[model samples]
Target: MASDDLFLTPLNALHLELGARMVPFAGYSMPVQYAGLMAEHQHTRTAASLFDVSHMGQLRLSGPDAAAAFESLMPVDVQGLGVNKQRYGLLLNEAGGILDDLMFVNTGEDLFVIVNGACKVNDLAHMQATIGTRCTITPMPDHALLALQGPQAVEVLKRLAPGVESLVFMTGGNFAWGEVPLFVTRSGYTGEDGFEISLHKDQAEAFARALLAEPEVKPAGLGARNSLRLEAGLCLYGNDLDQTTTPVEAAINWAMQKVRRTGGERAGGFPGADFVLAQLDGRLPTERLRVGLIAKERVPVREPAELQNMDGQKVGQVTSGLLSPTLNQPIAMGYVRPEYSIEGTELFAIVRGKPVPMTVTKMPFVPTRYYRG
Candidate 1:
């Protein structure tokens, strides 16, 4: 698509001013890199980095039946979600395939949700069509989302927004920067202690400038964000997950809260619950499972690369791969037969018609540093 036809975020001009290399992503002209990917990635791991994620869809769900009605679409314990708490969720099709992965927060009086930018349109339509009458779903198009990530994030944020130091991981609350109201969540995609703040689009540039003024914080872009998340073993929507992949197959069943599982009081209420529950009980065997692979050599293996067994038999294909900046070794995530999914199992990634040796390894190639306190 043409550049003029692409959507721009509230921080688009700021990104350009900072010399960010722009690229098309999820129908938006977004920054792919600024001050280099490797540098930004390392900075975020050590200190703090600001990422503009305003392209993501934000919505508010209200009404007395909001929680119950929302619970019908995903395998989450929304009824049990406490105020100011957030949880990961998956939107599923009737066939048990994943539609998208999202994060939702229980604000005392309503629900605040963030969905992938690419799937936002269809996701909203689906939710509205299914639960519109039961709840009020209001899209927040005038808001901009910002993710401030790293070990020093708390310290830097506390300097501007007081009382944010009290929030632990997966928790959030309404705060303010001067007169601008902010919804800040102590959570991020990079497996680090961080916060995602949503505020008026008009205040995004000024707020971002203030955050950038901090000595420990630098501007990061999507390229670094991708590598960071990959090192943290987080899933990227189109790559690691898709409409045909099930939560069980994607190895993210942990997101399915126990209360929504079989034998629980609210079991079988969401889409594809029957099939997902069967997989959980081992009554239905999963054909393939997502696992982490470590390349035996330094060569970087990328997605769509064929994964093979000892005799060159096709086992699966790589979904996401990158040379991890932190580990300085190549790592990948892909689907493979259950037998080959075990740790230490030998596998091969076919690259340039040559087989590169790989082993099934535990994920988060780099350890996650989440602050629960």
Candidate 2:
């Protein structure tokens, strides 16, 4: 893609001033690294790091039928979502394949949604074509997003946004930073105690500058963000998840609430409900299942790497992999045959024409520190 064809965030100039190394990501010229990926990753683990995530798609849905209308498209209990609470949801196709994964919050008068940058265009169009008549969908293109993440994130945010300390994980509320109106959610992709703030695009630079001025906060880029999330065992849309993957196969069945499952009041009302519920009930068989793998050696096994058993028979392929900055070891996520998906199952990842020993392990290579208070 041409440089001129890339979109620039409202804080583009600010990132340039901070010496951020820019690269094209999801149609936007974004900061991929600042200072160094390892240093920034460590800083976020101990203190706090601010990420410019303004490229994400933000939308508002309002209408008396909004909850019901949206519920028909996802396998979650949107009608039961209380005001100020957010839920992770999946958009599935008719065949039970995922279209996109998103976070949606009920903001009392309206529903607030945030989708992946790359899939937002198609996501919007799909929703409009399927459910637009029942609810009003308005894209919030003028909004900019920032993520302040780390163990000390709350302490840093509380200093400026008073009362935010009370918001627990998966909860959100409207607040203010002086005169700037802000909507903040106590959630993030890094599996850390953090908040994702949304504000007017014009105020993004100033807000980011203010946050960066804090002693505990530093500017981090996408490079650190990727490593952080990978260590957290979180899924990246195009990499760890895709249209060909189902929620059950992806090991994300937790996102499907009980209210939408087999015996509930509104059970099996969403798209792909029959297939998803069948899989959930064990009535359907999955060809492969996603699992975490720990490389026995220091070598990182990247995606598309073949996985094999002791007999040298191919079982699966790696989806995402990297040397974890936090764990100081190589880790990866991949899909394997049902027999090889069990934790502690031994396997090999073929990297560079060589077999790297690996073991299927429980995920979140690093412990998550989500604040529930």
Candidate 3:
């Protein structure tokens, strides 16, 4: 049942027409599944899948000091990002806590940023309140975001819009789908070879239907999106990360570029730089580190489940977990004390008051299939 207060994406009507099971997520009525969770999950692994991500916030920052000003807010190399190149970033507060994880692209003329749906309002306010005087902050709520992800995504997209196949990971370019304009980037949250296409909200359903016409493309929903991301070991904002977690503690150290680190040419200017950089450089002590876990048995250990050692003392808690559709094994990611963060360390997940034996493992239980070429 669609609620009156929940916002609807551009494709909301089409989703209902396709018999999608809708659910409220991030204050929007989103499709949980169309065909089914397992079916959509496996289809995305083997073929291309279309996801409606219009609920995410898209905004632009443009000015003479855009890159430099944006860099001062996030702990990433924003000024160093080449034109048309995209980079992952963490928005931090003064206390070194993550406000949100975002993806921003340097499009030569302006910075195009995509933030999580739930935190979009706050993210915009924070950016505007902090750097609005230095740059022009414009929100693009009229743009609809869609992700076409899988190994065959290139083949499906290139047939509709030529030259998309030439794009590599973390890069974007402007293209046209018939008369409609598209801004596409070779990236995705599913850890697959894919593209995130941005277009006008009015043309979204038409474009989506065009993609669906392809034999290789099927519409997936939030259910499979969550499972796919979990299997890929990607962090979910409110689940695996929040205001209480730092980048180092979340184990996403790669998002912080070298230039933002302690001894680089342009360093320690972003929020909480002293603390975050100290942790990154190993000068500051970290209490817990994020780790991957694999269950010994078939039981699925889910989020908020307490982790315990052999002595029955709680050492951690599961943040994300599911029975991986690709690997056919239960896998999870959680924060654990430093000593228990190493691979091959045995731990127990207290599910339903019974300990489920598990072993600390490496992430990407299913290897990422990014198209770097």
Residues 1-373 of candidate 2: C-alpha lDDT, one tens digit per residue: 2368999999999999999999999999999988999999999999999999999999999999999999999998899999999999899999889999999999999999999999999999999999999999999999999999999999999888998999999999999999899999999999889999999999999999999999999999999999999999999999989999989999999999888896857988788888888888899988899999999999999998999999999999999999999888899999999989999999999999999999999988999999997
Q: What TM-score does structure 1 among the candidates reach? A: 0.99
**lDDT tens per residue, model 3, 242-272:** 9999899999999988777857668778888
Q: Which ranges of candidate 1 are over 4 A from the true structure?
A: 1-3
Global lDDT of model 1: 0.94
For candidate 1, lDDT tens digit of each residue in 146-222? 99999999999999999999999999999999888999999999888899999999999999999999999999999
TM per model? 0.99, 0.98, 0.98
lDDT of 2 at 10: 91
Count clashes in each candidate, considering only residues at least 3 apart in sequence or on different chains. Answer: 0, 0, 0
By summed lDDT, which 10 consecutive residues of candidate 2 come out lowest? 1-10
